[model samples]
Target: MSGQHHVMVVDDEAAARDMVGEYLSLHGFRVTLCDGGPALRRAMATERADLVVLDLDMPGEDGLSVLRDIKRRAPVPVIMLTATAAPTDRIVGLEVGADDYLAKPCELRELLARVRALLRRLAAPAAVPGSAGRTETVRFGTKILDLAAHVLRDDEGRELPLTASEFSLLKAFAENPRRVLSRDRLLDLAGARDPDAFDRAIDVRITRIRRKIEPDPDTPAYIKTVRGAGYMFMPEGETR
Candidate 1:
């Protein structure tokens, strides 16, 4: 990881963009400001951004559209910003590949912390390289999770679509197989350190991951949910 991470902020409102970008800059991040999707595209064409802070309610080509494009082109981490507290809004963003989200009028301190946590998540794998603590791959059911490549492929080597949050959550489960993980503990392990990020968000990612790796998502055999506790990944389920 570099000494200063480059973060691109995309918001329609100038005030909102300036406020967020300036705050991130003050916290030792190199900030790039863009008003909408076009500017973001142009900036991305010239230089790469370590992560993106995207606003959901932009006029033309909303945040979801931009997020889709970003994932298609580069697949960098994203933290969505929105004014609405509606669960649906955040869930939609997450489903569309947003790594995490923050509601409007957010505390800069919280955003900074979230940014640091996300960077740490991205850096953790690199720090271990090929040492004994590093995982090359994890097997479950018929799917093979490439931890180094950050991908899930089937028996035929068909890659699946997995968002950053889902990948992080799945990795956490695989690393601590058969041990019950409370929602709060899962959040910390998944690099989601924001108080505003609800535990239900973890449930959403779990549901998404279950669809990919579980034989039957409805009755998940890999990531089983304890009635009163949290989730536990069944280590014995690996067929390979």
Candidate 2:
């Protein structure tokens, strides 16, 4: 990604879309504006966008649905914008693969900070291969994580589709299995900062991961909660 990164701003609100698009353009990003999810889909087909400034509330095919679709089809970094600051909504956004969420009535400065943070994270280097004799595959329950490909798959060999952030978070936990990881630690490892008032967003992501890999998501056998401590990943076997 270059200094003149391309960003797609998806928002139905004309004023809000213009404001964000203009600000990002002024700050050296090449921005393309879209009024709805359909327009966004069209724009994506033509150009590769480095990031997305997505609005949560839209007249049709609302932001959450778009978020899920984007995560599934293309794993681009997204900063979600919503008027409601409800914790449940924020959790859902993060769970479904929004990289960051901002409440509406938000300050431009804060949004800019979040955008920069997300871009920087996406640009981070992948984990390097260790020395000879190091563990290559991480196993938890019936799932296998391939660090190099950044993918998780079940015993049946079905690949679990995960967004970039979710893959990074799972890799962090798999690399340090069976150890309690605090929210702050997980954020640092995932190359993302904790969003405002949504620290439990990590837990939500973990729950989503469990649903894919664990036999029982409600009583997860792989990633276990450690009361107030945080979470611990129980690997099938000890790391060599």
Candidate 3:
């Protein structure tokens, strides 16, 4: 990782653009501010960026559209900012591959923390030697998950649309193949601070994921429920 990271700040508000850009610049980052999607695309074409700070609400091409384009064009880390604070919106953003998210009216310090966390996660070395450059795709039962691209494809090769929480939960299972991970451990991995608030939330996400990946969601084949424990991914060779 370079000492001076390049970050693109995308927001329609002038004050926000300046504030975020200036704050990041002060922290030793090279910042570029864009008012909308078109300007952002133009800037991206000219320079490679290490990260993107994107606003969810925007005129013309919205932030989500821009986020999709970014995922398609480049695998740069993205930290989404939204004013709504809606769980659905947050889930959608994560599902579509955002590295992190911050609700609007957030403290500058909190935003900075999210930015640092995203970058650190992106820069972290792979768990195994030679795994860094390997494509991160996991297959279970009738579904395939592309971690790098954040796409979930069914057995028939159709993409399954998932919410952010669902995607994150599924990814956690896929990465730890065949391991029984408890709710507390999962909350930590998902970056959620309150485990109780997210207790049934993870269950909901898992059920949603099972609907997409399982041959029979009612009696799930891949993601199995451990009666006394949490959840486990029963890979082909693993016993249920």
Candidate 4:
């Protein structure tokens, strides 16, 4: 299964990039190693990678900028490697469209685990929403989330790009409407729970999702925060 997918490792540090590239290669994945942003850009132009392991603390054209560019250019999943201990870097990376992040000097096994989990998600078949069947699409405001297709469509039927993480969260909410779900419960439902995930990771993801599905993200209607509890999915956008 891993043999079919291509993984790209982009880091300024030669040792780190080579280490990851070799490890992934050993695991039967086709791996590409890029020294920096320019190499990454060139590689992306020539071939599509199933996933990217991007280093956040590079010298020029930094990871955040590169992440933004990647999100704008493609829907490929990205996992950021940040050396900074500050939560701000992780938060900003998440906001800029990193599907996930890991601290620097991370364990090789853990990295491989993350890579496998994300690939599984990408390869997983579209789930049938409920036993009733055929009700695959759910509408929130003007946007529509298609469960079977794993894509979000605007009212005009144009596709809006959603990272695997975002789509998983939205699908979780759609499956359990009108129920207040705690952060842990939400992650469990979405199959995205990470031990290293920050407390506000879910909040950041919710904010991002709101921007796409809410008429007014500042005062979200579809996914409402339940104060101390968690969040509730109001399918009808009910105020009361």
Candidate 5:
């Protein structure tokens, strides 16, 4: 992929949209501005975007709905924006498939950095055959993670769709099994955009991964949340 990517900015504030659009434009992204969800839908209908910078506080069709719609309509990466640093909004955004997020009243430089981080992560090369051996994969329970294929498959060969963040997080966990991974270290090892230690970004991604790999997400076997310490990923047979 080229360094340039098409980004759609959906914000009710015209000034915010213009500013973000122009900033991204100057940074080599082709950007489109949308005033609301309807315009967002129209733009996506016209052409698929590489990423979306969406504001959460839109009228009529809120960003959560738009995020859901985007995932349902297309699986493009999205970065959500909110005016307040509210944990509820951030957590909800992640649950609804936003790839990353930033609080409003943020510096343009920070936003640019986050955009680049996510784009770079998305552009990372997949695992491919290089040696005279089978492609390396890790097994947790009945699910096998094809590191090169970037996919999780079941014993029955059913595929689970993982977002870029989830895939990266699971890879990190598999590589460092039986170790308590702090949220900061997980983000660092996973090549994710660093959020605050208190941010629920890492937790949300972990939850999503558990839902796929665990027989029961509520009480996970592979990925266990260690109270106040972080999380530990159990390697196969460790439980016994």
Candidate 6:
């Protein structure tokens, strides 16, 4: 499966790109090396990448900007690598839809582990029991969460892009509607528990989900904040 998937590594430094590309290739994964955002965009234009390993500090079009553009164009998972020690920097990466982040000078083994974990999660199916021919869906606001396809579709049936992490989080909410789930519990249910994940990571992910499934993210009707408790999924939206 790793051999069949393509991973793109985008970094301004030749040594950095070569190192990651070589490591992934050795691990039976197809790899592409890009010098910067423009190179990444060109590669993406010609062919699809299953996932992206992007470096935050680049000469032009920083990783955050590149990540925003990539998310706008596709739902491919991205793991950001930043040398910045600031938690705010990592949080900002998450805000722009990064699936995960790693500090610069990261261990190759850890990077490989993260890549495999994310890919596995993306390929894993929701454990919803249903008849073989039937589609499993859950309603969130005006959108339909397609559990089978790992997508959210609007009223007109157009697909709203969702990352693996986002889909997992939404599935957690759908499976336990109306139940208040604390951030810790939510992370456990979503299989998104990361040692480096901050408390606000869940909040950022919820914000992203709301932007897709809520009628108005500012005044969320589907997932409501329970003051200090966490959030509750109101499948019927706000009660009349």
Rank by lDDT, highest first: 6, 4, 1, 5, 2, 3
Please, what's the RMSD in Å of model 2? 3.4
Best by TM-score: 4
Give the candidate order by descending TM-score: 4, 6, 5, 1, 2, 3
Between candidates 3 and 4, the TM-score winner: 4
Query: Candidate 5 has which clashing residue pairs, if any?
Result: 127-148
Check candidate 1 and list the clashing pairs.
Answer: none
lDDT of 6 by residue, 1-240 (tens): 798899999999899889999999999999999999889999999999999999999976888889999999999999999999787788898888888888889899999998998888788776565535777888999799988888899989999889878888888888778888898888765543456665788889999999988878999999999988888999879552
User: Compared with the true structure, what per-residue lDDT tens digits does model 4 show for residues 1-240?
Assistant: 899999989999999999999999999999999988889889999999999999999997899898998899898899999899777768898888888878899899999998998888767765544535564788877699888788899988999989988887887888788888898887665543456664578888999999999988998888999988898889879864
lDDT of 5 at 76: 79
**Deviation in Å, model 1, residue 203 alpha carbon:** 1.3
Backbone clashes in candidate 1 total: 0
- Give lDDT per model, in order: 0.81, 0.78, 0.74, 0.86, 0.79, 0.87
> What residue runs in model 1 are displaced by over 4 Å at the alpha carbon?
1-4, 126-135, 156-159, 193-197, 236-240
Q: Residues 41-139, candidate 1, lDDT per residue (tens digit)?
A: 999999989999999998978889999999888768999998987777787877677888888988999998888888777666721234466657777
Model 2, TM vs. native: 0.82
Over 1-240, each residue of candidate 3 has an lDDT whose tens digit, in order, gives 435689999999999889999988888789999998899899999999888999998888888999998878876778888898557776676556665677787688887876776565544432322357776777766788777666788767777664444556666887787788997777666553322245554565676677777778898878888887888988753675
User: Candidate 6: RMSD over Cα atoms?
Assistant: 2.0
